[model samples]
Target: MTGPPNSPTLLREMSERIRALGELPQTSEARAEVEAALGSKWWGLRVLAIAVIGAWRDKAWLVERALRAENGMAGGRFGHARTQSWRDLEAQTAAKAAVPMLDPADAGWLLDRWFSDEPLAFAFYEYVGLRLDPTAVERRVAEEFARRRSQQRRLPLFRLLRLRRGVADRDARLRRLAQGGDETALLARDLLSMEARFRDRQAQTPGGAKRAKVSAGAARRAAAAEALAESRRRAGRKGRR
Candidate 1:
């Protein structure tokens, strides 16, 4: 599969992409490359895909597909490979457009994914090369976590729960999960603690949340830049060979 920084097909995609500006992106070949990278076992290849989709002109189904790929395969509630939870913090931040584009039904769907036999991988970072501003689909992610506090992948889901934090029953849910006295519950407790600290810190400053968000974004860009630079260095070596 070929795309982005180099590839004739990607150039074709660029052209088709521009012409279809008012509509969904029409670069089928480019989309295919993105899909392939999203599913690749090679982490570098996945990184490239992450960069690609971040800037892809196709904003509809393609973004949806990218979200699914990044969401990581569920490891089951108790056995959650905890796909999203385990994602590199920078990479998850880099996938700026991911959270907001989720379909509302995704909470239920992801719950199901959490229980399925999906194969999980941690590759996805290169391809297109950079992510745009994030749009938080906090509601959807929060729903997934709230429906089951002990659910697998609690990290990312819990992180997005700020909007739902006002719900009166969250403390009760946390208490219930904490009582489980299992690893899953333990992990949830840790994340909840961290979330509380973050929320409190944000509350303490007028622009603290914004600055923190910027910090996460900057970190993701730095990571992507370093990875892409390494990817390019290797690509240069390969071409010379």
Candidate 2:
């Protein structure tokens, strides 16, 4: 929703002031001025102000002040809490925060919640986090490996594909589905193989594996079955409804 970093005139003034300070600005007055500029009507000004401050990590005062300013904003408060619902933003913020003062152990937990058992997101974070701390990142990745083994203890796929095939190889849902019988395992394995193939193809290119595949046909069929089942259950729900 916000515009470019330097979009606002007030933000430009803030930048000029920050540039004048050269290093991180030390004075409480200067920090307050930056905060005031950031509090402008345009959200972009706030982003710029925070960004400028965060860029100077050596300035603990500036970073803390910027964080305080961010916490004061509506978006920072409500938006951050909403991270629990929106995995993308949650993962991004967690990954960014992990790079700063947060410990690698903490980063592992943050990455876990952020990825929400999504293999692709987990893999992406693993790669990025590696750049920050290789040993720690790899250890975090081992969690996913453990998850895969745990999932394998469940069901076996047959209908769509074997449990060993397709998208089932990577999807966390496949592990859950495996708890059922042959049919569940089969469908899960098929979906997993499909996802794996798609991801593999993408990984052969520039961006590596960032995209996730969802099957429209499969989703529609599954939704229809659920709807029919719900309709049948409606008979029992008549008085309750």
The global C-alpha lDDT for each of the candidates, from Candidate 1 onward, is 0.44, 0.43
Please list the residue runs of candidate 2 whose C-alpha ends up more than 4 Å from where it truly belongs after superposition. 1-11, 58-103, 117-192, 196-241
lDDT of 1: 0.44
RMSD, one per candidate, in order = 16.3, 11.3
Candidate 2 matches the true fold with a TM-score of 0.38
lDDT of 1 by residue, 168-218 (tens): 344444545555766445554654565455545665698877775645434
lDDT of 1 at 179: 58
Winning candidate number (lDDT): 1
lDDT string, candidate 2, 84-157, tens digits: 23333333333343246544444554445433422223333444434335344335444444455433322112
lDDT of model 2 at position 14? 55
